[model samples]
Target: MRDRIEKRMAEIAVIGLGYIGLPTAIMFANAGFNVTGYEIRKDVVERINSGKAHIVEPDIDDLLRKVIESGKLRATSNPADIREKDVYIICVQTPLREDRTPNLTYLESAVETVAKAMKPGALIVIESTIPPLTTVRMAEFIEELTGLKPGRDFYMVHAPERVMPGRIFRELVYNSRILGGITPESAEIAERLYRSFVKGQVFRTKSTVSEVVKLMENTFRDVNIALANEFAYLAHQYGINVFEAIELANSHPRVKIHVPGIGVGGHCLPKDPHLLVWPARDDFGLIRLAREINDGMPLLAKDLLFEALRTINLPPEKAVVAVLGLAYKGDSDDTRNSPASAFVEAIVDDVAEVRTYDPFVEGTHGSLEEALRGADAVVIATDHTVFRSLDWETLGKLMRNRVLIDGRHVVEMPPEGFVFKGVGRGEY
Candidate 1:
């Protein structure tokens, strides 16, 4: 088993080169292991092969270049090319259905693809963030397809990924990992491999528990954000700055609270909590309460802007609102579930025009200059680092009007004059 694992590590095949897969592949290569990134997108395959990253994760391009230069990393779209490896990790998308059901078609296809090429015994670890029963269900399908039993004919394990898009590499190596397998021995076997790269604890459990762990972690975040957002909404009614009150509460030394943004947005926090909504709907009704509060926050943010505009004596139809930041959060270009998008869509029904600017975004309103040009009010939906460092002097030259709506509370110096407002902070 040790010899077999050594050969597998010497040449590992990473299936589905996505945001999760690419970082995993790069890390394996960074550790001096040979890694083949198998992506379905021909363009993405070519890009990685040439040491260029499609996604904007910190230092990934540099790592990709280093690994490719060392001849330890490569990418290919052809299944025939992917057939020569031992370990295959499925990292394709697992988006939700219209009714918030977990869609596993991508996982199913990748399992079939690997099962066809995979030989007698190769370790297959699933690293997708899926709900309970996903790993077991996929394992059963793979057994039927390959005529192999888990931990006997081959090893099957589920190690759900706990990576933030911007901090993928650092977190993947340093954060605690939860490993689960069909059998006890299978869990041990998988834990040994992961322990090599991860500096943090390697926890072992059943496949179902491992799946649930990811959901629990992300859903907890969503719940906390919702709590903050709910308070922000209530505070608005009383003309109180929620952030100022939160700071006072934090002075108690027992409370550490998350800051309120326009809304909770991200691939994980916005959607993963709902992955279990269908299964636990009957017993766990409070989950629905959390989801409702969070999902409704974007609309609330829009309404707040409209109300603020009205206080200044401007109708929604006559206002020209500009948004700052489209990425889900600060410092990253990944916008899988950005709340700002929803905020724009919500009030656009009545507004004259809505412009947005994110330095991380490649196109659209493209630059900060466009965001401030001919604007009745500017709304800071996300708390990107660049927005915090904006020069008021430069913006003052480009501005058509003032009225800054700064959410996320990251801006230290509120956009000078022009009426600054945030979700939690009443006004400045």
Candidate 2:
């Protein structure tokens, strides 16, 4: 199997061509494999097959077109297209339910599809972030479905994606990967497959540890961001700039402080911490508290906007607020679990009118001018780069009143005649 894979003779099927899966499929195809992307969405398949990218990742469209033109990559919604592949890579989403429990429906469905379609000796690798022991349970589930023993009749591994949204393509190749297999042999096989495109180190381990590692990486960030948010609240009460204090504090080589924002958003940070505490028998107090603090940040931002509005004697029901940036983070078009959404939800009913604008997102205002037109207040929710260089004089004229609430602290200072309020900077 290794020899065939190394020789570029292995047929690779990447299931669920999402943010992680599409890039993974493209990279593998670029590395000389015949890659077929298996997607449940027929439109997505059609888009890719026609040389269009469904998701916005930097430089992915050109790469997708190149790979497709080379005949090394194709996308299909049909299950039969992937049945003959030597490797099946599942890149489906593992989102959390409303109660904050891990929702493995997508992962389970992908596993079932692989089990039904896989031939003997085929390898399956899960790139979705899942709860600990899920890979092992999935291996067992596959065995039950196919009547074939793992590590013998077939192989399974957990190699979760560690890339950020905007930099997924670069990170997929450069970031160190964790290849956790149900068995050592399975890990080795999985590592060999990744080595074709991965330029970074691939650490081999047990499936459960790999699962824990992915969870830990995001949980650590969530906790630190929660700490920063706590500090931001304290700074607001004390009338100090949290960003300035954080800068001075981080001058110490050992102390690292993450910047506080409207809240922790995106698919990973908000939900991955919940995965850690969900299955634990005891109360994981810190983890739960961190989640609460981060989750409450959107409301905190809402309060800041209200305070700004109160200063001008404008009630929310009479104010028109424009929310800038809907994506979770900057320079990308991913809106899953976005803090901007939370901010919108918190104030939609209270505000007289609300308009959203994102440079990369659709259904919002095409231009900042349009979003800010006739607005009484503005909230910087996502802090995209385009927001940083706004012409304040022009924007002030476009608004009914100049009330700027910087939720992410992206703006350094407000221009003359504009009332400025930020998350941590009080009366500055």
Top of the candidates by TM-score:
2
Task: Give per-residue CA lDDT, model 1, range 1-428, as digits (tens).
Answer: 54555444546788888889999998888776778888889999988888899999889889899999998888998888778466777788888877777788888898888888787667788998787787888778888997888678777788989977788889999999998887787788777666657898899999889888888988888888788888887787788888887889889878877777778777778778877554553656667688888878777667668767877888878888888888888887877778888787887888989988888877758677877887888888888877777786678667665676776776656655666667766543
Q: How much does candidate 2 score in TM-score? A: 0.99
Worst 10 residues of 2 by lDDT: 419-428
Q: Each model's number of backbone clashes? A: 1, 0
For lDDT, the strongest prediction is 2
- Candidate 2 per-residue lDDT, tens place, 1-428, comes to 99999898999999999999999999999999999999999999999998889999889999999999999999999999888689999999989998889999999999999999999999999999998889999999999999989889888899989999888888998999999999999999999999998999999999999999999999999999999999999998999999999999999999999999899899899999988777678888899999999999999899989988999999889999999999999888989999999999999999999999998999999899988989999999987898898888988999999899999888998677877888878646
Cα-lDDT of candidate 2: 0.92
- Tell me the deviation in Å of residue 343 in model 1: 1.0
lDDT of each: 0.80, 0.92
TM values, all candidates: 0.94, 0.99
